[model samples]
Target: MNYPFEKVADGAEETKLIAEEFAEELNGGDLVLFHGNLGSGKTFFVRSVCSALGIDGVTSPTFSLVNEYHGEKKVFHIDLYRIEKADEFENIGLYDYLSDEDAVKFVEWAELFPEQLKDYDFLITIEYIDDNKRKIKIERK
Candidate 1:
């Protein structure tokens, strides 16, 4: 479906539906780069993906930079808010995870490494409108 993004309605349930649809089509080795401002529903969508994958207790990796979850497959969710060096990420072995047969990845604040984006399978941008509405666009590189 070309990683098509759909506008999400207000509230968490609607967001879950969107994420579930995305998860239904994705598999291991797929990397999703997320671009969105704070409170733009980035983490919410990630959490919903986790839920769809049968993962429990999904939490933001705001401090840890990366969170690993084991559901249908391993999910590596990385947040680059604290990263000052994009090269340092390579040293952290993020690429290894993405290449792993049992792992999938989702990255937030990925704009820090524009050059590295070509490795991602899809790109996503989320913009907050009013109240709880969000405009999301997903594009293939």
Candidate 2:
């Protein structure tokens, strides 16, 4: 399915619904790269996606680098918030996660290492607006 950039300025529930839609349409081996400022609901969107995929308790892997949730499907949530350089992801075994059997990868702060995103399937960008609203864009490049 071709999902153009979608807007979700309604509420948090609306944001989650958008994530659910992406989850339903997403296939195995898909890589989702998230771009936005801090507190822009990147992790929130990821959490909802994981939840929709039958996983639970999706959290940011800030200190741990990566967190894995296992259920009907697996979710690999990677956070590059503390990385000083782009090469740090390689040292953290990014390629291994990518090769893991059909697990979905949700990455935050991806724009910091644009070169690393070449293999990604989709780019999800979320921008916050007034009154608990968010402008979300999901596109394939």
Best by lDDT: 2
Cα RMSD for candidates in order: 1.7, 1.5
Which regions of candidate 1 fall more than 4 Å away from where they truly are?
1-3
Question: Residue-wise lDDT of candidate 1 within 65-110, one digit each (tens)?
Answer: 8899999978998888888886877887766765777678899988
* Residues forming the 10-long window of minimal summed lDDT in candidate 2: 1-10
List, residue by residue over 1-141, the lDDT tens digit for candidate 2.
Answer: 466767765888999988887888777778889999888999899989888888887777878989988766777898888999867667989878967768878889899888867888899998988669889999986
Residue pairs in clash, model 1: none
How does each model score on TM-score?
Answer: 0.89, 0.92
Q: How many backbone clashes does candidate 2 have?
A: 0
Q: What is the lDDT of candidate 1?
A: 0.81
Error of 2 at 32 (Å): 0.4
Compute the lDDT of residue 135 as modeled in candidate 1: 81
Position 1, candidate 1: lDDT: 51
